[model samples]
Target chain A: MRPSATWRGLLRPGDYIVLAASIALCIAAGFGLWRGGTPDGLIIRAGGEIFAETDLSRARRIAVPGPLGTTLIEIQPGRARVAADPGPRQYCVRQGWLSRAGAVAICAPNQVSLILTGRGSDFDSLGY
Target chain B: MTHSVIELTPTDTDRRIARHAAAAIALTVAEAAIPLPLPGLKPGLANIITLVVLARWGWREAAWVSLLRVFAASLLLGQFLAPGFFLSLGGALASLAVLAGAMRLPSRWFGPVSHSLFAAFAHIGAQLLIARLWLTPHDGVFYLAPILGGAAVVFGLVNGFAAAALLREKAHAG
Candidate 1:
């Protein structure tokens, strides 16, 4: 039979729901595992007082995150300089190197956050 | 089915060409509905429709519909000649490759249903590889992996059923 260049009707509502749900599930799964709960990329920390400051020209962005609060930061070019201030727990230094999605490292009490946001703009183009 | 006005043309050849183009357009619209933050990679549902056309018609006709759909849609959607446009063009080309491979199979080796799924997998794999390498500027690629893979399986099954029904209907009518 010759191919009928027909306009098949719209997908039934139920079918649309099914396909959409599948898509959402896929996106969620990827983000949850790949970038969920990680913080190595460029992150913002909450500080009542000056805790530390780092130059932005050193970090390299290596990955893309799909969700909230996830990054992978590799500090090699320059170390983030820490400053003495008031907060509580100065655990900021204790937070180790970050390189995976969906993981976070923070300093409690001081309220300083150190996250890895996939591609650090500092060295994005430079980091192949 | 409610085909486009082109199908109502008086000329036979034109009608046939119009019908094929109409289907291609319809499939492209369906593909557009599946949204993602990033462009290029999709479940390749449009390709399944193209493959079905190839199976029902000839490869030449199918190729015409496929290219028209890609070029026309890219222009209409305003992705004309952009990087995403190239990705879609590459996807259409790769899909044709899969369709050719499937058509070469023995008649009884697998039904149209299975063929749709197979072609879908191939299309998704190629698009994924492209996205991982090109489109994704950051960790965003990670988010697309599961979605693309899962969409391939789910939509593949839906398209498979549709293809099988189409083939079965043709057989009975003949």
Candidate 2:
């Protein structure tokens, strides 16, 4: 059967409802997947294994030993940073403070890495 | 020595399905040539053919055209039996399943646009599920949900309009 409506008058009431619902679902997915909260703790890894996981509620210093030397991590309330590293470039130390969820500081030469974790902070993979 | 020859006869319905599947396959191969800014993001131009077929024929014919397009197009693109082939198959199957149910909606209200939107979303949703389960095997794949969802809405509407236009033209001509 030939369609009763043309392209000009194609959108029916159901069409409008579907369109609205699609756009709404898209918006909801964007917000739900992309939005992240502040990080609550920091995880330190050395030699490809988890070395330490601590909350950012108290100020503390963690020294994780790796192949090269000790990598010092300084944690302040709600934030953390790499204080020192034996890695040549000091890339992790230069990364400064990591406060947001999913943030990372990697000392490749020293084989140490720090990652901030919180609700909705999960990441599939991290690249250099 | 004597050789026996076998002959095959295809009925009218078979020819019609072949014709529609050929069109869908052509569009699929053509669409693959277009450069995409992001991985897994496609304009889904072939979906237009599926929507058109569904509107002109029925869900079974549309399913045949869509699945045939996936298989034939993959073979033509030299991606047969590859990971990309499975992705294409998954998306086609998901979308065809959705269209089957969507086709039952009241014609006075729902039409090509609604069916297209539903199929597009289902297509991407299934692809993402497959990628997470088999390919990436990580929850991080969900991070792409927003971008893909948005693409589905946009492309779904565009393809839907294209199908509507084709139906209109055919309606006038026939």
Candidate 3:
């Protein structure tokens, strides 16, 4: 149905004010949340238990005991990665580096996982 | 066993609400069939019926239709009493509250478009709050603010236009 001429008149100054205010609010809040800082450390898990948590600032290499064997994790200045995996696929090793909060890498066969965490990480867990 | 015949006749208002509720529920069910790339993102097409009902029959009838649609849709989708149901319930109640307030504005100042937009934001905002409090309890959930808010605006405009068109058709038919 075509909007009648009166329909266009439905929006008044007050409506525009409300709409503009809400839009601005959303933009501000969204940007502010997006600008949050990066994570500080990585939470490593093996065999469904927390294996270790290492600061991203300190570069180190650690081996975590897993179901299959040891999983090697490397931490750099501001990033972390699964350097090697005893698991068949080496899937975790291929996940590359994780520098941002909420980034995660897992070796399902070895039951080892790494999750980035920091104050800037906004979500507790990711949902698809 | 003895059978007693009983006839229950619904009033015009009841029938109108029933029809509106049914329409809203149909939209909800249809929306569920569409796959969304992200969680907490929906077109909220059923809200169009709420806007139409509020404009035509007032907030009371609209509230009935909206609540009925939520309850019925959850039951049909087998999400009753689940996290999804609570989220839906929270969003519906929050949107209804906003619509109730928005209705106080003069018709010439606020129509379906503005009302729908306000309700859309309220719906998403309430859902986010509920998710944070009960479902996830993480600050990261707020990361969805931009995407969900953007969707709310787009879907709100589309639903509002549809509701306005439906209202015009009703006016013409009457």
Candidate 4:
């Protein structure tokens, strides 16, 4: 078919329906995400229990008892990190800083973990 | 050897499939080289070849070319049997199924643009499903639907216009 000849025929009412529906869905979803807001604080878990919930805006440090020993957690303005861990590998300490909601750091040997919670953050964790 | 019972010659259709598949694979590789802003967000340039082939020949030809492109591209990218390969395969199969169904729609009512849009949605939707089922198994993954859907709408339109332009050019040349 000639390009010019079929140009007018490319779109039909059904096409408009699909486009409109998708646009509506996109807008609604975007609005929802926007309203969801950022996480307010961080949640710390140790030995499968709630250890602490600290406000992200405040700068503080806490030591939580774990299987191996104490796991020190540090929270600063909009960020949290494992300041120190008694575990041998120090994997949790190596996790560095986590500022975004839904970010998590685990010290498996110490049975201590930190999770960031808030609005707008999606996905429990990322996978390959 | 007195006589050969089976013919092993490459027919015109076979040659055409090879050419189209190669072109599509090249496009796929080239696209992979470009850095993406986010994971699972691509312009899907290779789909243009599939669109054109579907329009010029038929769905069967288009399917063969599309599948061949996926396999060849995965092998070349060294992602065969990996998570990436499975995601690509799932997305391609879903899009092909969508295109096949979209073919039944009236040609005047459904053109390259509509077909592209449908296929794009199907591709992303299938990938997300696979990710949820096998990869992540989390509800959080669905949160990306809005972003991915929006991208699909934009790229679907762009690819559709491109395919249409290419088809027009080929028709004029012939």
- Model 3 stretches astray by more than 4 angstroms: A1-13, A38-128, B1-6
Model 1 ranges off by over 4 Å: A1-128, B1-15, B30-45, B137-143
Off by over 4 Å in 2: A1-8, A41-97, A102-116, A122-128, B1-5
State TM-scores per candidate: 0.53, 0.76, 0.68, 0.65
Task: For model 3, state the Cα shift of residue A26 in Å.
Answer: 2.0
Instruction: List, residue by residue over B1-174, the lDDT tens digit for candidate 2.
Output: 899889889988789989988988898888888999887798888889899989998888888889889899999999999988898899999999888899999988998989999999998999999999999998788889889989999999989988988887899899
In model 4 chain B, the worst 10-residue window by lDDT is B107-116
Candidate 1: tens digits of C-alpha lDDT, residues A2-98: 3452322323334344345546656777666554432233444554443333433464433212123223334544333223323345444344544
Instruction: Rate residue A45 of model 4 by lDDT.
Output: 93
Q: Identify the candidate with maximal DockQ.
A: 2
Winner on DockQ (2 vs 3) = 2
- Model 1 interface CAPRI class: incorrect
Best candidate, TM-score = 2
Candidates, ranked, lDDT: 2, 3, 4, 1
Model 1 residue A112 distance off true place after TM-score fit, in angstroms: 16
**Superposed Cα deviation of residue A109, candidate 1 (Å):** 14
lDDT winner between candidates 1 and 4 = 4
Better of 1 and 2 by lDDT: 2
Compared with the true structure, what per-residue lDDT tens digits does model 3 show for residues A1-128? 36576565445556577667777877987888887647788899988889887788888999888778888999998888999999997777877988778888888999998998887665665321
**Clashes per model (N, Cα, C within 3 A):** 28, 0, 3, 1
The CA lDDT of each predicted structure is 0.57, 0.88, 0.87, 0.86
